[model samples]
Every structure is written in structure tokens, then in C-alpha cells.
Target: MHKSIMIQGTMSNVGKSLLTAGLCRVFKQDGYKVAPFKSQNMALNSYITEEGLEMGRAQVMQAEACGIKPSVYMNPILLKPTTDVGSQVIVNGEVIGNMKAVEYFRYKKTLIPDIMKAYEKLTDEYDIVVLEGAGSPAEINLKQEDIVNMGLARMTKSPVLLVGDIDRGGVFAQLAGTLMLLTEEEKAIVKATVINKFRGDKEILKPGLTMLEDICSKPVAGVIPYVYLDIDDEDSLSERFVRRKEGGLVQIAVIRLPRISNFTDFNALESIEEVNLSYVTSPAQLQEADMVIIPGTKSTMSDLLWMRQNGLEAAIKKLADKGKIVMGICGGYQMLGDTLTDPYGVEASGSLAGMGLLPMDTVFEKEKVRTQVTGQVTSPVGHFKLLEGAAIEGYEIHMGTSSSKSGGISSFSRLEYGLAGKREVKQDGYIMDNILGTYVHGIFDSEEFLEGMVKTLLKSKGLNYEQVKTVDVKAHKEEQYDRLADTIRQNLDIEFIYKILEAGV
Candidate 1:
């Protein structure tokens, strides 16, 4: 039988994802077949599996760390928030329906069977499964209906390690208060407590650790130091949004949509030293940016309307008209078109005018397109001219189709499904003189794609750019997994974790 352990957090963004990933790596390094599992994930950042299914990106990252292929079983329930209190609920990698927060809380109980099915499949295939919890288990109001935290641990009979973020302050209270809030039965599943994102001398933290353990009645598993590993963040709380704009050779600004999804597409460009990426939210921040990009959004029409209301749409149009390079991906690609029609009212009812930068029209459909893709660039001009003929591979996840109205303008890329499939889509996105848009989300992930983009973006700024060092994103990720494992192994009691797994709750 497969052994299991789960990482639960005191609150959101408490490093449960990273810790789970680290443990996965450690288990893999110790010569055990491992996989990552999360009963329910609520995040905008998602990934498309090889089988054309969708799952949370965090579990995908953890799967990478474990050196295993990601499956929908890793994240059976994905909630992509569309509005303040409503989200599109996806089960087994397909959309079920949109539900309000309260509705999901009441309806999620019905999904416990689906969760167990996925969990059982993973356990049967792997020697160990490292599960991750969503949000805090201390939320007394959400405890009863929860399928993600203590509930999942109970279901799997898996021991839990609670993580508290020291960087956020009140590490002790965060840890102790969580234990105090949980029921006695819930507390029994907690194996240990980990302090994440610590930045101080260990000696100075000794006394606090003692008091924390005393208050929580749990051993301190580890004090993980602050790490700056380049990994994809799962949601809007990503630290990348608050980074200071650097004066690199190329200045790229991505409009921070209210409902942005999969901003990790730009991770490769951000990794380049000569490229400075800033998440701009307003017209003022776009003033000095050489390239303005509108990223994918959960609610394209609503975000587009938001841009129009806040003068961002006008600013982008003005820049595009002035010969500045402007680009869009997925929903942003849809918004760049001349018109957006939603006869099915997927995002909203009726049709709306787009920014009119690209000569295309988008029609939102009821069904969503989710697939991994590969292709070569056919028509790349303006800032992307160097990328022409360069090989590109990525995934597509969108509910709208963008068709070119101008027959003269060619496609941005010629694509085929990355995995074997019978459905052959001839074209993707629309291309023009200085405006390019695509539904491909991870186009920049490959080495060739990044090389062309970085060199061109830098050369446009009058700087001679060269690839003095080649970076393979896949290789870099492997190195990061090892680094993360080394860090965690040095701090955490891995032997204790082994014991917890052996003695399942």
C-alpha cells in the first residue's frame, strides 16, 4: 500500500505548495516513486495535461519535482474564480458549472467520491503521494464542508504537517492559533509544524520556536529560510506583481487584469537578465514600457470593459497606433480583436467592441478548448520578427475562437496538437504589422522561443544582445528542484517525516 503525508498551511500563500514540492523531491531522491495530490485547488493559474485535461499548476510543479507526469488525478477539483464570489468549478479536468462560494461549499460534498477515485488511482500507481491542502483548516466556518485540508487528511488517513509563514509575522500565533482552532480529532492528524520563509539567525529564533512548540504541542519540523527560486506561482498573490521595474535593455509591461490567469507564461522572459517585466495595472505604468502585453484573463469581456472604463484600452490603442509593439495571449488575444461576440453569454450577454488593434473577431463558445500544442511561427513581424520560423510549443486553454477578418494578414503560428490527436487546427491567433496575439500560453517556455524574444526585444533598445549563457527552462527547473530539496533536507527533519508517513493517522 502507498504511504501518504499532507502539507497544510495556516493560511493562503504560506508555502504549502513549495513545502510539498520539496518533500516530493526528497522522496524521489530517496529512490521512491512519488506523486503529488491535491483534493481541491482554488487558483487562477492552471495547466493543461498531455491528455488535454486541466489541473492546478502547483500540483504540476510538484509533479515535476517528483519527476513524474502530471495527471488530472493530482488535482481533481479546480476552482477558477470568475467573479468576487463565483468560480468556474472543474472536476476531473473538465468544467462542471459555475457556482457561488456558498453554493460550492454546499455542493462540494458531492465530489468526495470523485476525490477518492482520483486519490486511489494515484496511490495505486505511486509508492508515495504527497498531498497539498488549500487555505487554512482553522476557518471554523469552512471546516465542516471542507474537502481539501483536514477533511482530505481524514479521508486518506494521512498525517499532516502545518506550515506557518514567518515572513508574514506572528509565526507563533499563526501556528498555535490554527492548532487551537481545530477540533481535538482534527489536531490528531497534524504530525508537526513548519515555519516557512524565515529570514533571521537560527539562534535568535530558538526561544520563539520553543514557545511555539509548547503552545501548539507539536514538534518544529523545520525553519525554512527565504528562498528566491524561480518557480511558477499558483495565483494573484504572486510576488512577481510587486517587483520593482528594472531599467533593463527591454522594458515589457503586462497589464494586470482584474481576473488574470496564467501570467506564468512570461516567466522565461523575466528570467532573462536583459528583459525587465513589470505588471502594470494602470495607464500611467504603461507610459514608458517598450512593449505592452495583455495576458490571459478568466473574464475577458469584463476585464476588457474594465480596461475601457479605466482608460487602459485607449492607452493601448494609442500606443499600438504609434507603432509601439503590443501583444496579447488567450483572452487578451480575444480582447485585441475588432469585436467579441458572446451569443451564449459565456462571459456576458451580447457583443462588445474590442480594442480594434487586430483585424479579427472573437466568438465565445460554451465549450472550452484545452490542449497542449506545438508548431512553428509563420508570421512574426514588428517586435516579434526574429521569432519567425522559430519552433514553439505550448498549451491552449480558452473558451473563445479568434478568426482573422483580413484575409491578407497571416496567422501568428502554425500549430498541431503536441500530443497525438486526430483534431488538426490549422491556425492560432492573428498577426499584423505591430500587433500579434495568440492563444498559446507557454510559447516562451522553450529555449528557442526565449532566445529569439530576448535578443529582439533587447536589440530594439539599441543594445547588442547575445546568448552568452543558454538556459533550458526544463533543466533550470530540475536544478531548482534539487536546490529546494537540499534546502529542505538541511532544515527539516526528513526522518521524522518518514516516521509520520509510516505511522499514518
Candidate 2:
């Protein structure tokens, strides 16, 4: 059996995921086979693994940091919130059904066997398994049957490193209060405490750190600085969702849907120097943007109705009519069609009249489409006309099928892969004038495609579109992993962490 150490947060977004990833990198760099495990994850942002299995993207990032391929076993249970109270529950990369918060909480303990099975697989394959706990483990009411956090730590005989966010203020209270609230046995597993996302002088914090250590009976392992990393984020709480625009030649505004998913699709575009990308919900924000994007969402019809009720649908239509670039992906692509028919009530009952930007109709199916694909833009339209025959590599994870209905519209791309070995020459996406829509996620991840988009948008503004540098998105992500590992190894007590693993609890 392999040794394991788990990181539990004082609260959500306290850098648990990043720290877990950092440690995974550090362990891997030190020549130990490392893997990350999250017993349960709730996030809108998800990923399809190489085997076509679904998992949380955070584990996927951690897997990359460990120099391993992402596996569904890394994230055993994924709960994607479709409504305020209910979530679509996925187990072992397959959806079981939807469940309310109370329903899931009551039913979760039954899955301890599944969680243990996944955990055992990781322990058998790797020398170190870096486990991450969801939210705070100190929710006193819900800690009874907790399969994550203290419960998981005890099961794996793993020592815990509790992390608290200093940037959120009340860091000492957050750490001490949580430790104090835990049952005596639960508190005993916490080998160390970490103050994350700190800025300014470490000396100023030394006094309080000592007092916290005394109160909690745990050593302050580290005070981690607030560092900007270009890694993939987990959910809507991400800092990227904040609305802010840097002045640039090409302005792009993404419609911030209420139930946005896979918004990381635009991360590559944000890395470009000349592109100013901001997420907007109001109609007024669309006017200043050179290109407006309708991103993927969990509830297509509901979000489309929301856009219509809020006048954003009309605003998008007006912009497209004025020859401004309007593009959509997945559920956003479904919204751009003439109609959206959900016979089985997958999204909602009956059919919804779309924005009519594209002459296509979408029908939701019970079967979800999940696959990584490699293709090329066989043809192009509007601002991206220069990208004809450009090779593209991305993925498709959706439930709706869109088919064009008119002569004026043309296919955006042709797929040579990801059709399950049939060698499909399938045409994806629809193009009509300045309006474009596709179901491919990470389309802009390509250097060829992104550079072409920037140059075209800049030229359309009559600005000199020269001297922009090419960017490799993948290379940047790798560098970020190294940086994160370096930061954590420098600040955190890695020697003690190694000792904790070596002792095997």
C-alpha cells in the first residue's frame, strides 16, 4: 500500500486544489509516482478523459502536474449543479441521475465502497496519493457520514494539512475555529496548518501564527504568498468570471450565462496580448465589443429564456445584424439556432424559439456526447475567413444535435477523428454571414486559429495588425505547474511532509 496525505480547507476556494496540485508536482519531481484523488467534487467545469470518461477538470490538472494522464478514478463522484438545489450526479464517469442537496447528502454514504475502490486503485499504482477534500470538513451537521476529509483520512491512514485563506480575512479564526469544532479524533489527524494566499510581511504574521499553533495544537506549516497561476480553474467561483477589460485593439465579450460551463475554452484567447476579453451579462456591454461570444451552459433553454427576458438576446441579434462577430459553442450553439426542441424534457418541457441567428434546429437526447477530437476547418466565414483548412484539435461534450436547414449556411469544420473509429467526415458548426456557432470546446487553443482571430479582428478595426507574438498555450500551462510546485516546496515544510508520508501514518 502507498502512503497518502490529504489537504482539507477551512472553507471552499482556500487554495486546497492548487496546493494539492503543487504537492503532486513536487512529489513527482522528487521521483515518486504521485497521483491526486478527490472523493467527491461539485463543479460546473468538467473534462472528458482520453477513454471518453468524464471527470472534474481540477483532477485532470492535478494529473498533468503528476506527469500522468487524467483518469476518471481520480474524481470518483462528480456533482454538476443544474439548478439552485439539484445536481446531475455522475459516478465513475457515468451519470446516475439528478439529486437534490438533501437527497445526495442522505445517499452519499452508500458510495463509500466506490470511493474506496478508486482510492485503492490509486494507492496500488502510485507511491503517493495526494487527496483533496471538498469545501470545509467542519460543517458540524454534515460531518456524521462524511466520506471525504476526516472520514477519508482515517480510512487511508493519511495525515492532514489544513489550509486557510488569509486573503479572505480572519485566517486565524478560520483555522482555529475549524480545528476546535472538529471531534477530538478528527482534529488529531491534522498534522499541520497552512495560511494560504497571503501578501506582505511574514514577520507581521509570526505572532498570530504562534498563537494559532498553540490554540489548535498544530504547527503552522507555511504561509503561502498570493501567486497568479495560469492553471485551469474548477468552477464558477473562479476569478476569471469577474468583469474587467484591459484596453486592446480587439475587444471580445463573452456572455456570462447564469449556468456557464467550460468557460475555460476562452483561456487561450485571454492569454493573447492584443485581445481584451471580458464576460458581460447586460445588453449595454455588447456594443463596445468587436466580437460577442455566447458560451456553453448547463441549461440551454433556461439561459436562453433568461437572455430573452433580459434583452440580451435582442442585443446579440442587433449586433449580428450590424455585421459584428457573434459566435456560440455547445449550449450556446443550440441557442443560436432557429428552434430548440426538448421532447424528453432534458433541459425543459416543449420547444423554445431560438435567437434565429442560424438556420438550424437542436434536439436534446438522453445520450450525452463526450469525446476528444482532432479536425480541420474545411471552410470559414466572416471574421475567421482566413482560417480555411486550418487544422484544429479540441473536444465535444454535449447532448444536443444541430443540423442546418438552408443554402445560405455552410459547415465550419470537418472531423477526421473522434467518431469512434468509423473515420467520419462529419461537418460540424454552422456559419451564416457574421454569425457563427460550433460545439467544439477549446477551438481557440490552436495557435493558428487564435492568431488568425486576433489579426482579423484588429484589421477589421483598421488598426495595424502586425508584430503580435505566437503563444503556445500548453507550454504556458506546464511552466505554471513548475512555478506552483516551486512556490509550495519553498514555503511549505516539504521535509516534514516527506516524513509524514514515510511514517505511513
Best by the lDDT measure: 1
Q: Candidate 1 lDDT (Cα, whole model)?
A: 0.89
lDDT (tens digit, per residue) of candidate 1 on 1-505: 8999999999999999999999999999999999999999999999999889999999999999999888999999999998999999999999999999989888999999999999999999999999999899999988888899998899999999999999999989899999999999999999899999999799999998898888878999889999989887888999999887465667899999999999999887777777789998899988887788899999999999999999999999888888778889999999998899999979887999999888788889999989998888888876778888888888999998877775523587888974575757568777777788888998889778778877766666767776524479999899999999999999999898999989999
Estimated TM-score per prediction?
0.97, 0.97
Provide the clashing-pair count of each candidate structure: 0, 0
Runs in model 2 deviating more than 4 A are 243-245, 406-409, 419-423
lDDT of 2 by residue, 357-409 (tens): 88889989988988887788877866777677777888888988888785333
lDDT of 1 at 143: 85
Task: Give candidate 2's whole-model lDDT.
Answer: 0.88
Query: In model 1, how many backbone clashes occur?
Result: 0
Give residue 15's lDDT in candidate 1 (0 to 100).
95
lDDT score at residue 301, model 1, on the 0-100 scale:
93
